[model samples]
Target: MPPLLAPASRSPWASLPEDLVRLVSWRLLAGDLTDYVRLRAVCTNWRSATMSPCGRGVIDPRFHPRRWMMFAEGHGLYPGHERLCEHTRFLNLDSGFFVRVRLPLFKDHCVLDSVEGLLLLQRDEDTAIRLHHPFTGDIVELPPLASHNLHMSHPYANLPQLRPISASVSIDAGVVRVMVIFIHLMYAAVATSQDTKWTYLMHWRLPSHYGPLSFRGEQYLVHETMNIENTYLSQIFQLEAHSQDPPKLIVTFPREKLCYPVYLVECDTEILVVGHNDISLTHLAVYKLADVVLDRFIPVKSIGDKAIFVGGRNLCVSSKALPTIVGDTIVYRHPREQHFMQYCLNTSSWSLATDECSTM
Candidate 1:
């Protein structure tokens, strides 16, 4: 005969072996850094067993927010909507899933640009700049643009004087390098984690440049200029990181079309040129490298199961991860439109993305 005894309470998640937890955490980190973060938040034991994204720092490639884009949710907020608005909504371009995260950085900073899920945030108080990863809550500070000696001035001193046209960040072996292109500055600014002040690269000849697009650890920019023949010309320039030397020109070609706003996106193994045929944002022409030596691009009708999310930094994602997203399509938001839109390369048609992918 034995007395009845209550069963000991235990959490299966907490009891998971440390070695198994580490393996699972690393596997999740490779695919989705957000998921790996959630796994750690499950229990104290699990958190201790997993490698913290913050511990490794934002420079670590494992902490990169891959295939994630912050959603633009501009809507009137009421009392009931407070909770919904408290968290920032990030959409997974590959899986079509929404991840809600509370970021304090957004409260006091305005996002100047975003690349590979890293936000170039400027503080509202003094326009101080910082690189932030929303998922990992990691931050790297940079000196304010005004702190640098620039003689340009205008009568409207009260207004926002300077703004970053575009920015690119490259991280290698825990070393971080940032390149910023300004709207009115003749020189581009380059800085590293080791530098206290920005290094001005005064060798750029073109006044209008689209991007310092990072492809395979190298930075590239589409330098557009008007020729004396009354035609537009675009040249590709490779920006050398951690160097004060001038950007190296990769190729030069005349633009047959007046494609005003162009984007150079890094796809899996190739670099893509995406542009709007007109200001209406209705038509898009996608191009890929045809000749490596010549740097010639050819129009492409399809990109297989890959999808491109267009923005300041265009992202290319595989649709196979989530069949919900239509493959071979470009997802973009028009400057005049309130919601997002999609252009299907296969059909050469346009559709409203709000119906398929709703923002927060």
Candidate 2:
């Protein structure tokens, strides 16, 4: 018999097939976006694989610390050139450069929130929606609710089946795909933590606006919640549209009796943002479409308390908190630690490069 010999060492990465490796590389480029952005524009294969569920992946352990800010300056010589106009307009938040879009003008509007590379700006109640890419100046106008069909006649029953509409954007490789979701759940997550995790909501594909069955539209709104109950809510009610046909409610928060302001933030994931209200004893209620259902809330106080983000193997929040006149306001977070230790988005987050972040 041959002398016993030590088993040959197995290479940890040797068993993974080439296709699996390709998928993973593509996923890393897409999922680990803090660094992979430059690579996304390198090839079409990488671009296609990362823009969808099949080839896409969740946030990478090695990603984040993405220090993206709106830049405002450009080469001075070509100030008036048509090609250089993109860097000339001003966005709601002064990211440094001016942002000019070619969509119809909106009035009494507010820039709600944004994700990926998209901005969720709303005006005229969600009846009129616009999907615009900040860099490319591409705009897609979302269709009005099914109720808008009644202008032809008061016979509102002829309106097609109404479904909740919302928008989401994900960056894969370098390709930014703006997605439209027509589903029942405002947010999707695995029903349980221990099993195969899959988004619990069903993705309903209505005919695109190009087809005969097309009653579809899109927007950049986030935190879309609706209460199927029959309760008239407040403040948020100011954003409603007036028409013979009522706009179908989209579940935004989850409840109605919300007595306080439900603080909302666009974190890295979609979770029911409930607060512990370290300061106040009341739970703030914002509108979820229209009805009020306090039971649907995830019991917490001031609103969403924990925001889970990561940078490489390190899991952390994007910002930090410091003692302020009011209370503990987020100081500077991880990737942006060098600045903005006391400011937040839409507030003093960008008042100036050197102004005290204490007040925006």
Candidate 3:
């Protein structure tokens, strides 16, 4: 008979190296807070290694966090899950995680846009705009639309139909600045805490859609226009911080290749202009600004591993952020329809996504 071997002892998790434990903890940071807490409870070494996670762990560039499509008004449907509650639902395509976020502040407000996890809300009663963070529960109110003169001769009823088409926020040195554009009025308004009233920029209308982009501590309003000769031009305006001066035109597209319905997106610390062909609405042209001062836009075939979401608001995210979201794709909702559509950059194809409200 073989000699009896001593029972092997189980290695304690606390014996693991601190660096290894920290690396494992970093991955858990993207998950729910409860999961991170549970991970730290496993052993003393892990608890000490992950004690400084702050709120959410720093996002890993190589493996980006999944991007979710947040419904502003109603709930979203997952492929295999039951219907979610109303208010706001974030649907993760890769993991099929449909989460409903309750926002008491948004009960009677219309969601105008979403950026960097912040929702731009407009009140139904008086068109009061505010920014609310669903995750942090922080709210910042902007100057009411009623404060600004619509310049209309008669009293305008149905103010909700004239909601601001675009809104953007910037924070610097612990100060918050917000910009809102009212397309019908052809006006852009800026408000800062130091100012007693909102500053208005008039006669700054673009023929097509426009949005705001904050880059490198500067605020820019980007839009497209048509010249007298029927040429398409992409325009960029630089808004001076806390200044009452009108926004200055800093850049314009050098060529007439682009069409209407242009959108500006900031990706990888650079600016990208997206334009759709008006005739077909099938082809999209993407350009990268090589030199903003020179107003140069170089055509590009692909946007690298980034997927852009454009509609009432514009968002750019990496494909690695969500496994099911394909790279070099554009996801947008039609203005007239309730369904969502996706455009593939590689194949130049169009397809409809699952409609969340259709089931209701």
Name the top lDDT candidate. 1
Q: Single out the weakest 10-residue window by summed lDDT for candidate 3.
A: 57-66
- What is the alpha-carbon RMSD of candidate 2 to the true structure? 15.4
Candidate no. 2 TM-score: 0.33
On residues 169-275, what C-alpha lDDT tens digit does candidate 3 reach at each position? 55655456767666565556777534545666654543333566644434566666667987767677776545556677777764445555667777665777777
Query: Can you tell me which runs of candidate 3 are displaced by over 4 Å?
Result: 1-69, 72-87, 91-99, 123-129, 149-158, 193-197, 202-232, 240-242, 254-256, 276-283, 290-296, 309-312, 317-325, 331-344, 347-360
Cα lDDT tens digits for candidate 2, 90-190: 33211122345432332333333233334444454544434444443444444433323333232435222223334443333433333333333232111
Report the candidate with higher lDDT, 2 versus 3. 3
Model 3 steric clash pairs: none
Best by TM-score: 1
User: TM per model?
Assistant: 0.71, 0.33, 0.62
Query: Which clashing pairs does model 1 show?
Result: none
Worst 10 residues of 1 by lDDT: 151-160
What local lDDT score does residue 43 receive in model 2, on the 0 to 100 scale?
52
Give the per-residue lDDT digits (tens) of candidate 1, residues 110-153.
Answer: 77777667888888787677888877688888877555545333
